[model samples]
Target: MELTINVDETTRNGSLLFKAARTNDTGAMKKLLESSDVDPFIRGNLEETILHTALLNDNKDVMEVIVEMVPSLINEPMTSEMYKGETPLHIAILKQDINMVHYLLQHGADPIHARAIGSCFIPGPYGQCYYGEYVLSFAACLENEEIVTLLLKHGAPLQAQDSLGNTVLHVLVLQPDKEMACFMYDIVTSFVTNKQKHKVQSIENSNGYTPLKLAAAEGDTQMFNYLVQKQKRTYWTMGTISYCVYDLTHIDTWGDHKSVLDIITSSKKMQVRKLVDIRPVKELLHHKWKTFGLKYFMLWMISYIAYTSIFTAVCLYRPLKRMPDNQTDNFTVMIQKTLAESYRTKGDYIRLSGELFTIVGAVVILASEVPYLARIGPRNFFGNASIGGPFPLLMVAFSFSIFIAVIFRLLGMEQESIPLSVALIIGWCNTIYFARGFRMLGQFSIMIQKIIFGDLLQWCCLLFISIIAFSSALYILFQTLDLTNYPYFRDFQMTLYTAVELMMGLIDFPIPYNNVTPSFIYIVYVLYMIFAYLLMLNLLIAMMDDTYWRVAQEREELWKVQIAATILLLEKRIPKFLRHRSGVPGITLGFNDDDKWYFGVEEIIPEEKGKIQAGGIHMAKSVGWEVIRSNLARIANMKEYTESTPF
Candidate 1:
């Protein structure tokens, strides 16, 4: 009869072979492997290999013993559901056991191809393992240069990507260790050939982030600079005139068609603060605006002018109306009178032309918004008021008003003028949208809009409350007085009107001495002035001043955000054939053989090429880099090179 050997629950599920492996009991492991019932390769509940179980207890001797008994277990992977595809080498590197790692590599362990894709490596809510899924990546993440060098020496492929398509360099940026990232970046660049380096640098991960682009998204400036420096090739350096060609594909859009700019300029994520504060990104945008943005903006402006002018002409040249004879004329008779008078008027040709053009303009403006609505999604298009400015909202109102006015005019309703007046006001105000084309005017326009919506809106709320309070108090105080004594305060409506007029400095003293006490009336008048004019008005001025300085500081960045939005919107309107007709901005960076659709080149003088560390991140300062892009030859003679400089 066989009696069960009761073991501690801690000893790997009480399996004798696993227990022997964990405790470094080579004799027990040998006896267990020899048993017909016990298989050395049998996986327990967690599916850990015997080698894996020995490594867990740092039992290199047990690992060697097991390997000698069943040499196949040396490279055997953990076939468990949770830790599938994890090899002994991957376990050694993760354990940071350099001796074990050496032993595994010496025994012909597959370092490059064997990916550890266990539950431990997958990112999730509880915690994340940011390292790529390979032994080389695991060693690099640990920053154990000895193990990394050993793995590389043992012929680990430098260009290998893990389960998420992230190369070791891509994984380094996502880690919080900047020094390790920089050190590994230097190592990778030095070890690889130029062609291999470009492949490693430009290959985007599953989330569409290259190593450099990932650094930008992670806001790791030091790592970003180190990566940027590695990719740059000094084309010609003659004293002060040095032209270094950067790989435009470094910052180019990834497989998802999302560029570095798209990630950094996201308002919802507030990533502008993360990366746009860097100098190269700013110059890149400035270069893009100069190259193709100015022309598109001018076209949008000219179209807007025509749109507004047509609507204005329609209102200005409306047919003249004759007054109805009696004030109490029936609605049908009034409509007939208005139609007859409008038909009898001269200048019918001008009126008809204006009306036709106005209809076309309103329809065009309404239709143009559909693209913007679709591109940004309804939440962002409506929520982010700064992007579209007030123009989108005003255009919508103006279009609706124009449609209503046109319908009323056709129906012979005299109220057509009411909606027309609203459209005319909104149409003129909508011109502020074009102000963004000019730098100074654009920032100033943003400031004014900010003040109106922020400070002025709050002031209006306070003003309303004060008015209602004072108006009620004064109405009750002056109720017994006759109209002859205090006509402005005799009724509740009149009292409210008088209160508003007093606030505006449009009314004089109107306190009556008949019913209300002179002192109380005087006190009320003084209190109204103090609360509404002195306090509220002055507070509004101070609030505006605060908003002005605040907006002034961020005006340039704010203006650039609007410009980015403009570029995205304008590109949507351009026909793809015409957009790609000139080989200007688009070029093939030979890394992946894919043409970069959005990119720019930065030119920097050698004297100003030194890197500046900003908030512990390296960036360029002092007119860092002036970005320029045109035909490939004019920017850089080589099609393979795309440049981004220090600043």
Candidate 2:
């Protein structure tokens, strides 16, 4: 049964033949192919040929027929002006058609061909084409191991380098799969050994780094250990000691570099020598003593003075008023009663006075301890019990004094107010002193801890102190005014106290002010609170944000170093043809004005090419009033400025 082929002569006009090929009309397609009048490779205006159209549509049958009819078409190089110089094979690879790949390869398709072999593949229809390599690289990235192996086995050139001089091994190393990495390692190793006839020594990538360096930078303990021990025992020995040291510093920058190194070194019992020979142990100890001793001594003296004063005041005054003698007890009682009366009349004054005294006392004490604290590492601030550290103990004593004062205020005991007030004064002193001395201490603590308190704990503590102080003052006020007889006064006092306490509690818990209060007083209070909160929050957020950003930036730098290391390892494994160049490896890809890739050494685009380039301001020349009026009149005549489109 002979099939009669009906020819469409108009198929050759523009994209008619391409459209027919895309549609896979075998009879019409065959008629067009058999007709010598029609150029089998006639491309559309967009440079899309019949084969390209067929490949774009994934029409395997049409492609097969075209290749079979004109075998010469398989060898003809299409200008990138059409399909960017990508052959039918390149299109098939880009389309990820394994069947088409097999067919094209069988029909003399060159897998190793590159549109722009040494430069970044440009995506235009008539520029450089490296679609096949990119497609393969992407496939490897997706962990399609079978397809990768198939492409390699079918003369896909395992050693084929990209514009960046990156081989398949480099791409595989970048894959986020441990299994894939291991598989790639095995395949690459096997290929290298078989091809080179000797075990691979060093494998540097386009970035002048070996695979070992990449693994080290990545903190990939298993891969690093395997490469160092299994592949080349001297791999780690080849680099300068400074380089190794730099690598070690970067370890903490990436994921748990220290931990990874610990695992590997411990397992292998590797003895890591110091990058440089340091001073003798005794010398180091002597130097430390000389440097820190005087500072510690001064701090101790200062701490002693502050501690002694507060301790003396609390002990002496507290016991004196409680003595057995009625004269002393009466005198003390009178003094406390007068102070309470004063506090009731002027609450802000009392609070301010207490705060001032506390701050002054704390400053004197902390100033003394500063020398000692500064000598120690900042992280030691949080460590349990300093061997000779008086700061922690002094802090505890100061806190206790404040606590006692709070109790006395709450009890409304007349004699106790003296000691209570003293304690409150000292507490503020201690807080201010510690804050001033430990300028870097907070940052160091956060860096080491990486905790985000969001000001919750600090605010809570402040709120608690404020509420207690206010409540005690209010209670004393009610008693002084003798408002117990007036029900409204009693109710109002209790209600205001509760509401203020609630506000204080809400503030401490970091609840939004708007959520807690609706009244004008509260609204004003909230506005003030928010202003203060924002001021403090801005400082705190700036500190924490800077710390976080610095850490992240450091980690990124470490990762790049690790990538360089891994590339080095691969370089030693691959052949000379697959290796990267000396200076900036040929594979270093950078962005253009449009964020597209470009070859050659990367340089930052001029500001004019950036998304938001700066331009000189254009100031209009000043016109006289008459001139302006004339211009306005002329413009007004152009169109009526209606209400809908008012000029």
Per-residue lDDT of model 2, residues 584-638, tens digit only: 1111111111211111111132233223211111111222334433433322221
In model 1, the clashing pairs are 246-642, 246-643, 247-642, 248-642
Model 1 Cα lDDT, one tens digit per residue, 538-615: 898899999889878877777777776676556556655434211123323222333433333345564745443221
The TM-score that candidate 2 achieves is 0.35
Q: Stretches of candidate 2 above 4 Å error? A: 1-14, 44-46, 75-85, 94-99, 115-155, 194-203, 212-538, 541-647
Q: How much lDDT does candidate 2 score?
A: 0.43
lDDT of 1: 0.69
**Overall lDDT per candidate, in order of appearance:** 0.69, 0.43
lDDT minimum window of 10 residues, candidate 2: 583-592
